[model samples]
Target chain A: MNDLGWIDAALTAARPQAVSALLRYFRDLDTAEEAFQEACLRALKTWPQNGPPRDPAAWLIMVGRNAALDEARRKKKQTELPEDDVLSDLDDAESALAERLDGAHYRDDILRLLFICCHPDLPAVQQIALALRIVSGLSVKEIARAFLVSESAMEQRITRAKRRVAAADVPFEAPGAPERAERLGAVAAMIYLLFNEGYSASGGSVQVRVPLCEEAIRLARLLLRLFPAEPEIMGLAALLLLQHARAKARLDGEGNIVLLEDQDRGLWDRELIAEGLALLEKALRHQRPGPYQVQAAIAGVHAHAAQPEDTDWAEIEQLYGALERHQPSPVVTLNRAVAVSKVRGPAAALAMIEPLAQPLAGYFHYFGVKGWLLKELGRADEARTAFDRAIALANTPAEAEQIRQHLDRLKEGAQRKSGRGSAHPAQS
Target chain B: MLYAILCYHDEAEVGSWPKEKDDAVLAKRALVTDKLAAKGRLGPVVRLMPTTAATTVRAGREPLVIDGPFAETKEQLLGFYIVDCASLAEAIEAAKGMVKDGGGAMEIRPLRLFRPGTTAGALAAESVAP
Candidate 1:
């Protein structure tokens, strides 16, 4: 408690709960934020000398509510101050909540706090910004740096998002089961979007924003805490963990993209792998297979294999099939084709993705995979054409460079042969 | 021997709980503590702040600071209890009694106490007693 670092952490850990409870009191985002800040300021002054409160959130809530009410009264606002007995009732409620409130109610409070930030009315960027600002307690400057935007712009964006949430009149009452599930789905998707915002940055123009990924993980963990029994939430957390476990090995020191098969397995974070596997196993036991669970299971298989040669591509292909059944998409099939190439022959894989040409024409990975399959089949000219199109469609310089490597191989294969080509250029 | 029983749990839910709910949890655990206290075996019990509020200082060739607990364990260490135990088996038994139903682990470690100011060079001359 005497340590400033500890105080900082305690305040951060207490933010969602204190702010949400304050929101319950004031029913306004700005007011709740101001009150929580005030409480934190007071904690800094008092806690170092006296030691931490038994329950930091509860202490902050009581103090914040009083501070807000006092300010309102001092300003002589018409905001009806509850009678003195009402104050006692507030204390009674806080002190006797074991008899009044169950774990589910508090869970909803936190969920509602998170769900409000990700209202459907908000755009994807705004939703991510708001969640980082409110739920994760990221400073505007910190978030701006992560997203590569100006601090003022990020602050304005968060402010606008919060205003939109308030204008949407999102009901604060504990939602019905169906509505709660719907809100949870939206929240989960928003978190995934946040993670992808960071995870998708492959260096170059957009520097890899690891903090965004870390913050997204923290938000997922917080959501898991609120809904421990939800298997999909478990899968969601597991997926992020397993994917992030390979973060260090995903790119080389030269900032070139490293394919999963080419990655150094020893660089992967084993602790995260173990935690992810534990969560995935627990989720699978629930028998409620969702998209996230299937994806996590795929990552799980990759994690279980120590070496690329030991990879169970067959299981990965099957999982992708199940994923398609759950949520059909051409992109998913394109990903599955790469696995098909590893398990079956290149011809089989090429035939599989032949139909995806129109649907995935604009997708970079589609052409990249097509080129790889064509190269494996010793179709030099066709592989070169596919590699050319892939380079054109690549999102980053690193992506373009990978395709360029394939094109270079095609050129070498053509040069060494007197005629066009026979087959198996690499083998020869 | 003295054993330090560390409690690890997912503190996101516990830390954010309201006063009465937090009290109810502690009181229920007090049921286990009461027996130990009666036997004069319990030394001290502490409930710590969540890991979010933690900071780590690395004492390498050059001092460095980092945010968060930097703990490698899956669950965060939420609290601890010091108790007098006859043997490692006794410490394990004490730990099992303290573990409430949840997703966490209890690690019991043998400890030594050093009273720095008791003598000119007070090493482990006097151990903590309850």
Candidate 2:
């Protein structure tokens, strides 16, 4: 629909692999990042007219590498730098560049780059942030928004990350099993974080940030290909797929958070459900489950349900119990409380999470869950207070609105019980 | 066939190496390196100075000189290895077992092959191919 139709498609298709390859070549995050940007600049100028090349990833990698190198050289000649237009016209050399960099060379460069980004030295946050910024080509502002950090802070974080990699001089080679295993956890964690950023959107924006989810899924698939028999990796990929399947029903028409039990089952993406289900089945066949696989299996059960009532709440609760065994945390307990409510009523669920209050005091979801449980227990006063706290801690406007809805419902219920008119104006 | 086992550590990661932990780490590294040398895999093991001794240069501009590392952060390159091995997989497998002295960190990368008559593209292809 836009002027540069084919070019856009080509860039979209090639970007992940191309950027992955460039990252391998440069080893430095900034260098790889700058190279990809340079490639895009050239593509915008050239691909509109001469058309995309035979292999877009290869084309981009080759041209991007040359452009990056040229820029490096040009920096050396900065005072006598060539005219801007002449330097930019290098975009026209796509075919020659592709001819020079083709086939197997292309594949390894990218694989190496992906491997490097997963270096065991970086923390999970830095690893994911670096991959998103360097490999997926997200801007600092965009990444910062996803992380709820300031742009300058995120920029500093990424800059520091790149410097660390450079100082480490992390190699550009496919590591063996032991090394791969250590790095794999980091890579899998990064991909999952990428998907979560997309999945957790508060639904206020018109654009759903679906591309990030798609990119994460694509990277997960690519990673699984690299390590086909790793059970945890299989679990990680399946988990994302299953979770992503429910994207459609997560938000309501007014963009409020729709609890899973309240979602319209028919609206869920069946194709994604089918793929996710198939993947979970395959992962289970490994007969060696990890936390991610167990979580995916739980998601699978929810996805298979035709209606909220049909959901196998007991089974879901059991899976959450297992997940806790595998990776214990208050968050897992908080999630299990929902399923506990379904199986054993609100009182049992309340008992389960109350012990968690001290640790989870500042957590929005914890208070939100507490508010919902208290409301279900006919404890309106306590519920309103919890909802007020939840609203105060809300990460987005939609979250605040969701808590307000609970408060409004509680007020309406109280008015009906007393046979008296409501005193306060209700939020929609 | 020489492998460089480089140690790595993230500055902000929880749980630094304690004294007993440092002793255990050194013991493990010594054990692994001895095992490698026993099997004729170890070439030379040397720990690099911290990133404080590092310098970086792009293509130009007086190398944009700075004090210490280009970026200031907690993670640093601790050390490395040069070992003889038949293949990359073997080298990397050995490298993974190499830990930081005093609980620092390490990483392993096969030296990029810079053969005569081969273009950078050809070498890049061979090194990078999946």
Candidate 1 segments whose C-alpha is farther than 4 A from its true place: A77-102, A202-204, A412-428, B2-4, B8-10, B13-130
Note the clash tally of each candidate. Answer: 3, 18
Q: What is the TM-score of each candidate against the true structure?
A: 0.74, 0.62
* Cα lDDT tens digits for candidate 1, A163-279: 889998778677999988988998999989998888775334453467787777777877776676678988998898888888888778887667777788888877677667767
Q: What docking class should model 2 receive?
A: incorrect
Best-fitting candidate, measured by DockQ? 1
Candidate 2 per-residue lDDT, tens place, A379-407, comes to: 88898888899989877787787778778
Evaluate model 1 with DockQ and give the value: 0.05
Per-model DockQ: 0.05, 0.01
